[model samples]
Target chain A: MSFPPLLEDLIRSLKVLPGVGAKSAQRMAFSLLEGDRLGGQKLAKTLAKAVDGIQHCTSCRNYTQSELCDICANPRRELNGEICVVATPSDVAAIEQTGHFQGRYFVLMGLLSPLDGIGPDELGLDRLANLMATTEVKELILATNPTVEGEATAHYIAEIAQQHNVRVSRIAQGVPVGGELEMVDGKTLGHAFSGRKTL
Target chain B: MSFPPLLEDLIRSLKVLPGVGAKSAQRMAFSLLEGDRLGGQKLAKTLAKAVDGIQHCTSCRNYTQSELCDICANPRRELNGEICVVATPSDVAAIEQTGHFQGRYFVLMGLLSPLDGIGPDELGLDRLANLMATTEVKELILATNPTVEGEATAHYIAEIAQQHNVRVSRIAQGVPVGGELEMVDGKTLGHAFSGRKTL
Candidate 1:
């Protein structure tokens, strides 16, 4: 005996969310149905609007309702001639929070994974190349994650930057500020030691 | 600097799901926006339908699109004249999965928490009482959680059962079938000792 059809559908549909499984989906469905019908309605409306309206930014491949994302549309952000290339839009949000980088961004949206059929074309490397070649961008910062695919994606984009005669650099990988040295992973500790700076 | 307006709205909306915080919401939003727009649209449609269509079963208080839930609508389930009272619809599902009890259910939807303003009316105890007074229900099984509020609710419902001259029984509280004696909590162990029966 399963749940009523509508409740079961809600639970099954909720599993579309990342990291949500059968149990979590059922809990979410029950919670919404039991108490937060208004919140559930609002979420449904917002999700529908977002799914229908949001599109990739024409220039940077980031999600946006408009043709260009807010960051790409801003003229002042382009003054530095520096373009940061990252794997996803959330990466852009993270960098923006730092308030240090004053340049534009190029969101790859994904990395190169041959086994999964994700390659340069899937990452929109051609768009990133065109942006670099057409614009007077002075530097390209590779800020993908520390994963193997991220490194490969960064290297592939570095080659594109080299072809465009744009100076390319990678973000520093080291021990995080609040992270204890002993708790740091071997690869990160290795990077920290190799990339040590003089005081 | 934040995410695009639509993306931000989606993230905020996703936080309505239980256990989803800002970070998890952001990840869910990105996952949907990045690759699962079809899934997102389906979820939105299903969620909207569920929020608008799903309502309580008039008899059992379980979620259903129609007037009566499947179990309550079936004639065979009422043969034994046994009705199990539970705190939530999920509890009904749990009892149904066991297949041991061939009876109908009364869903309280919540425990009796006076501090939270949840009392008899909130749990629809009057409806339960009406059912008991009118129907041929011979026994009412209390299957609420083992928490304090659950016990209080069970006792409260037991009083109603007594008033209606219906037999009342509380599910046994003891160490689980596979639970280690040392790992069992003191309260459960004490109940296990007091409620011990001949093998």
Candidate 2:
């Protein structure tokens, strides 16, 4: 009535992924088994190697196999004395793609959610503080999302930067580029009004 | 600027799954790396095992780790002397879920697509023919999807079944249960009219 034991196990294990449910898992299992066995085997080998080998970058808390991530390891990035602090590695990638920021990054890996037991220590704030105090870091840009927890995390990090005498600034919040002002949410429009700047 | 090598590799490899794109793959990779490393490792191990171990059932071509699939190996299912020919194992699962049919299954794994070079041999029609000719199968129920290729494949298989003196029947094509008459397509309405029977 059901799939073979191993196939069933694979489907169940696949559900551990974010956003994947029973139907998607079944489709994935069947697609791999019926059409692309080589891709399935390659995925298995790569997944095992990545899970076993990948670790956090010692300096920024970003994912990396080596002790330091690519940006943190770069001496030129250190010379800029600017560190953009974000909540996750995907945020770091987003900023990097803009090709504008020449500084390093500090990845918090998560926001400060006390209810979920995530706090300053969990976000690796102590390591960020150590870097700010020890390095010639002059500016800290808070690029966390514009959620309540993200704002709280940024405020917490700003206090740490103040103690280290490093200037701190939060990324601007406004109507997004190419977006209609009428389509913008009330909260975002409120932020746009309050954070208005002169030309 | 980019993710670490191992993380990037994992993201790329995760794209092998159907419906997964760059963003989804990235999300899956980060999700596993950030919070579910144990699950990721378990998935890797199970995926490898399923890829290596799962093979076609000798009798019905359904996926199985042993010589015969559970349904084909059962004597009760064989006693009906009916074989339901379907395009994929998922179809078998769907029929089994209904609990109405007590016959064995013949999985084609794919439809006959001459342009894609999928002929009778590719669909393992030879083995199906052998089973029909040698076994006590009294009827063959073609349960392929209601598509052009499915119709072609059903007709092809019906010819083979006729050669072996087995009664062949196609699953009905009509307005689905609970569907509105007006909403039904013209072709289905036509079929529904032609195939109508006394209540």
Best by TM-score: 1
| TM-score list, all predictions | 0.93, 0.92
Model 2 agreement with the true structure over A1-199: per-residue lDDT tens digits = 4689999999999999999999999999999898899999989999999999999999998888888888889999999999999988999889999998999999999999999999899998999999987889889999999999999999999999999999999999999999999999999999999999989
TM-score of 2: 0.92
lDDT of 1 at B25: 97
List, residue by residue over B1-199, the lDDT tens digit for candidate 2.
4888888888988999999999999999999988999999999999999999999999899999999999999999999999999998889999999998899999999999999999999999999999988889989999999999999999999999999999999999999999999999999999999999999
Candidate 1 residues A1-199, lDDT tens each? 4589888898989999999999999989988987799999999999999999999889988888899988889999888899999988878888999999999999888889999999999999988899887888999999999899999998988998899999999999999999999999999999999999999
> Judged by DockQ, which candidate is best?
1
- Give lDDT tens digits, candidate 1, residues B34-151: 7799999999999999999999999999999999999999999988799999998888888889989999999999999999999999999999999998899989999999999999
TM-score of 1: 0.93
What lDDT does candidate 2 reach at residue A122?
96
**Candidate 2: chain B TM-score against the reference chain B:** 0.96
Residue A144 in model 2: lDDT: 96
